[model samples]
Target chain A: MSDAPREIDALIEMMARLPGLGPRSARRAVLYLIQKRSVLMAPLAQAMADVARTVRECANCGNIGTSDLCAICSSEKRATGEICVVEDVADLWAMERAGAFRGRYHVLGGTLSALDAVGPEELRIPRLIVRIAEENVTEVILALNATVDGQTTAHYIAEALEGTGVRITSLAQGVPIGGELDYLDDGTIGAALKARKSF
Target chain B: MSDAPREIDALIEMMARLPGLGPRSARRAVLYLIQKRSVLMAPLAQAMADVARTVRECANCGNIGTSDLCAICSSEKRATGEICVVEDVADLWAMERAGAFRGRYHVLGGTLSALDAVGPEELRIPRLIVRIAEENVTEVILALNATVDGQTTAHYIAEALEGTGVRITSLAQGVPIGGELDYLDDGTIGAALKARKSF
Candidate 1:
C-alpha cells in the first residue's frame, strides 16, 4: 500500500506480523526506522539477528536464554524445591520483574484448549512432571492465569501430580492493588471476600 | 527487568523507542519475535539491514528511496507541471493510496514551526522554488495538514512564490467522507458550509 522499495515493504510486512503491530503502525515504524537508520535501525537489526542466532529455549524449563539452560534454571541460588508453573515465558518475566519469587519456573507455553486441540503433550506438561522427580521439588505453585483455559490446565496438572507426594498450591485470588472495589468484577469481589483473613 | 539475555533486552529497549510502543509492549513484541525466530524474526532482521544500507532520501523531493530519486520523482508518467507538496513522506504515501493525484509530489519533511525553531530553510521550500523554475512547473498544490503550523508553512510558501506566475492552490476543506455532522468541530462545519458547491 506504499511506494516504498521492496525491501522496505517486506520489512513493514514482517513487522506487521508482530503481535501488537498492524499494517498502518508497521508502516509508521518502518518510516521511523528509515529516518533513524544509524542510531536505531542498524542496531535493532543487528540485535535481532544476534538474538535469532544465539537465543535458545531452556532445556530444563521453557524460558528463553543463550544456552541450553536459562539463567534461572542454571543459577544455583534459585530454590530447587519450589517450582512456579506459568502459562508463558512472558508471565515468567512478569513474575521475575516483581522480584518476589526466588524459585525457578516451568513455562507451559500455553494453556490447554480443547477447542484448539492443545493437550498436555502439546504443552511442556510432560517435561514439568519429569522435572518434579528429577529436581526433587517439594512444592508446585500454579501461577497460571485466571481464565477458563488456564484454570483447566491448572486442574489437570494438579490431578496428574496428585500421587507424587508434592504439595500443590495456586496464587491467591483477590482484588488487585490500586484496583477500586466498585470497578472490580463480581467474581473478583466474591473471591476477595472469601479469601479475606483477620487483621 | 527480565532475566532474558542482554541481546533480547537491547532489542526490547530499541523497540520501546518506537512511536506507539511502551516498555511492556516492547517486551511482548520481543518475546513474540523470539518465539517465531525462524519464520519471522530472521527475515525481519535481514529486511531492516537491507533497507538501512540501501534506502536514501530523494534529492529533489525528500522522499525515501533506494536511489537519489524517489519513485514519484523518477516516474516519466507523473505530470511534472503539477507538484503536490506534503509535510512528510507518510502524507505522500497517504495521497498515493488515494490514487487520485496523477502529478508529482514534493515532501517538505516538516511544517514550519517557530516554537520548535523550524523555518523554510530547514524544510524543502528553497528546493521547491528552484524546481518551479528548473522544471517549468505551472501549479503548486499545498496538500499540507489542516493544523496551524501546516497552514503557516503553506502561507509562507505561497508568499515566497509570489510573481513566479505559477498557479498556487491548496486542498479544499470539507466534511470528510462518512463523517457525522454532530461529531465535527465548528471550524470544519463552517468551512464545509462556506465551500458548499452548487449541486
Candidate 2:
C-alpha cells in the first residue's frame, strides 16, 4: 500500500535502478524531490531531458559529449601526441579531476573478461590503435585498473601495439598520497617496497 | 578539465544536488545513465516530466497526488472517524507501508520549532481542528517524530484539542520489535524500562 501517487511511485522505482541508489534511498530521494518540486525536481527533469536530447559519445575517442568529438578530443591545446587509455568514462573523469594529464583519453568502455566474453573488439581497442597511427601518437599510457581483468587487458593491449613504434607505459603503483602506513594493504606495501625509488 | 560534454556535465551537477548523491556518485550515476540512455535514462526523464506535469498536492490532506483530493482522503472506506497526523509526506508513506491504520492522514508539513520560527499557522493544525468538527472525528493520532520539535508540536496540538471532545493519543515509546537491547541508546533503554509490560 504505497502512499505516494502512481507517478511518484514509478519515479521512485526508476530512480532505484540508478547506480548507488537502493529502493529505500530512492523512496527518500523521490519524497525529497516532491517536497522541492518547484526548485530542484523541475530543473532536474528539464536537465535530464536536455541531456538525453543532446548528449552523445565522442565518435573518435568514445568519450561522452554533446558533439561528435568530446571537448578534450576536439581541443587544439589538448592534442598532445599521447593517449591515455582507461577502462571507462568514470576513470577518465577521475584523471581529468587530477588535472595532471594534458593528453587526450581513450575510454575502453570496459576491460576484457573471458567469463563475460568481452574481447578487444568489443571495447574501443581497435579504435584506439587506429587513433594512435592517425594522430601520430608517441606514447600509449595504459591507465587501466589494478584488477586482474584490467591487468590482463593492459598486457593484451601492450602486445597488440608491439612494433607499432608507440612507447607503451602504465601508471606506476606505489603508496598513495596522504596514505597511512598502518592502514596500507599488504599488496600496496609490497609494491611500494619493490618499486622503492631513491629519495 | 572535464572529459564529459557541457550538457552532460550540467546533468551531473544537477544530479549531485539530489539529497543522497554527492559529486562523485553523481558523476558515476550520469555515466551509467548515458550508457543506458535508450533503456533507462530516457524513460527516467520521461517519468520525471510526467510526474512534474501531473502531480499536485491534495488540497484536503496535503498529500501529493494527481488530483485535488488524494486517494486516501477521497476514499469513503478511509473516512473511519480517525485522522493520523504526521509531520511530512514521508512519514505518511511510512505509515501506509505499515498497513496498520485504516483512517486517513493529515500532513503537517513540518513540526513546530521556536528556534526556526515555525509556528502552528505554518503547519496544518487549524485545518486539523476544522476536520475534527466537520467529519465528527473520534480519534486524532499524533504520529510525529520523537524529536524535541515533534513532541512540542504534539503537545501543542493536544492542548488545542482539549475542549474539542475528540480523543487524542500519540504513538507509544518502547523497545522496537526487532531492536537489540545491547545496541539500544541510553534514552531508548530508559524509555523501554519505564514502559515495561507484563507477559
Per-model lDDT: 0.93, 0.89
Instruction: Report the lDDT tens digits of candidate 2 across residue range A1-199.
Output: 3568778888999999989999888988888877778887888888888888888888999888888988889899996699999999899989988889999999999999989999889998999889988999999999999889999999999999999999999999989999998999999899999999998
lDDT of 2 at A52: 80
Chain A TM-score of model 1 versus the true structure? 0.98
Candidate 1, residues A1-199: lDDT per residue as tens digits?
Answer: 6867778888888989887899999999999999999999999999999999999999989999999999999999999999999999999988998999999999999999989999999889999999999999999999999999999999999999999999999999999999999999999999999999998
Q: List the residue pairs that clash in candidate 2.
A: none
Name the best candidate (by DockQ): 1
lDDT (0-100) at residue B30 of candidate 1? 94
What local lDDT score does residue A78 receive in model 2, on the 0 to 100 scale?
93
DockQ of candidate 1 is 0.86
Which candidate number maximizes TM-score? 1
